[model samples]
Target: MDVSGTRATDENTRPPAVIKATARQLLVKVGAGGLSPEAVAGDSGLAVAEVEAVFPHRDDLLTALVIDAYNESAAAMERADEAARAAGASAGGRLLAVTRALRKWSFDNSGEFTLIYGSPVPGYHAPQETVPPASRTPAVLAGIVRSALENGELTPPRRAVPGPPLLRPEAVELFGGLPPAPFSDVIERGIVLWSSLIGLLVFQVFSRTHDSVRDESAYFDFAVAVAAEGIGLVVPLDDGAHTT
Candidate 1:
């Protein structure tokens, strides 16, 4: 039946996946500088030639990892938003759900999170192909804003931020233009919100606020709620606690 040859073919097809998995492990242990075809081969029990055959170049492997991490993180947020919508949560609540999903993903895959969001990989300039996946996470935020505006759930902020079009032309085109008047600034605020969310996770994942923040989960909710206000979304703060 030539079972051994068939098995060999199957194994050959899986080297990229195996090599990437091994690379991620090494990434956590020794940082991006430690990544190389030989390192992945040694960890995956594959020949260096096999790893190189799959990745072709070190930058190729790094790009794949970046894209994978971005897509996975975006999927996590998308899933959370879908579930929140199914549950009839408010736009603001969905925002919270997605942000919380990101935090959860960052916690679960800290190494991958750092790979994408932490310091830039030394000398690795990700190609343009990385942009689409990189945009997915922020696109999730933009989608939420668009949905909210459509449903009349999004409010216009009282004060303008002094810039009529804070979103760049490319960003405007990418997001399909800003939400109409009064809400025109929502996307800009959303950009701020997105950056704030990432900054919050970065602080926690990198232990920047360990000494100061008493309760990270609670703090995140508070910070997100505050940020959401700038976007005209009203996220509920801790429901149980009464502040005097």
Candidate 2:
């Protein structure tokens, strides 16, 4: 099961226990500034040469960690969604629950969130082949939008109305009735919220601003509130009502 060895099984076929353990340990110690392969090898009790043999470079380890963090976030969101559904909440309620879960995840994993969103490491090209299917944040946000529309939470633009509203879609089910806005807009706004939250934490983390702000939990709560406000604007509560 140790992948950092010669003649190892295909990565896809390897058990995740070893990799996950190593990654978890590294992340706990090194908050997403990224870790060297040598560091990971020492922590994992594997030989430095063997770590290089498997990961080849620091980028591989970072890419793996990013993918892992995203998967964990998505799973958490899914659980929140399921809980909301069980409570007989509408799709809009479920979407908000998922969004809140994501915000909480970001705050909890600030290091991982910063690495994935704040900045990309130099010379670290993500291996397209190794990227997870559900790790794309934009696509996930788009799915939430579609769900809100279907749940009668958002309104499509009305054609018969004048100007911009007239040009918008009239209903959620009708593709043509959907707004002309691109998916990128939603993704960008989400990233902005995430980055803003991280920036606030980074300032506090590095002692760059507000020397008096010693309570990390208080700052995190403020950041979450800001992120929630951004989501409210991007998704808009009135869309569903407008459509109805």
Instruction: TM-score each candidate.
Output: 0.89, 0.57
lDDT (Cα, 0-100) at 180 in candidate 1: 69
Estimate every model's Cα lDDT from 0 to 1: 0.80, 0.53
Query: lDDT winner among the candidates?
Result: 1
lDDT of 2 by residue, 1-244 (tens): 1222221234642323444456556665765454786676777677777767666766666666666666777777777777977987655555555655665677576666666655666777666643553344434444655565455554333222223432222222222234344321333344455456446546654455556656554444545445644434332243232100
Clashing pairs in 2: 153-239, 153-240, 154-239, 154-240, 155-239, 155-243, 169-177
The residue-by-residue lDDT of candidate 1 on 72-165, one tens digit each, is: 8999999999999998988888888888899888988888899999999889997887888889999889888888888988778997768457
Can you list the residue pairs that collide in candidate 1?
none
lDDT accuracy of residue 19 in candidate 2:
46
> Compared to the true structure, candidate 1 yields what TM-score?
0.89
lDDT of 1 at 48: 90
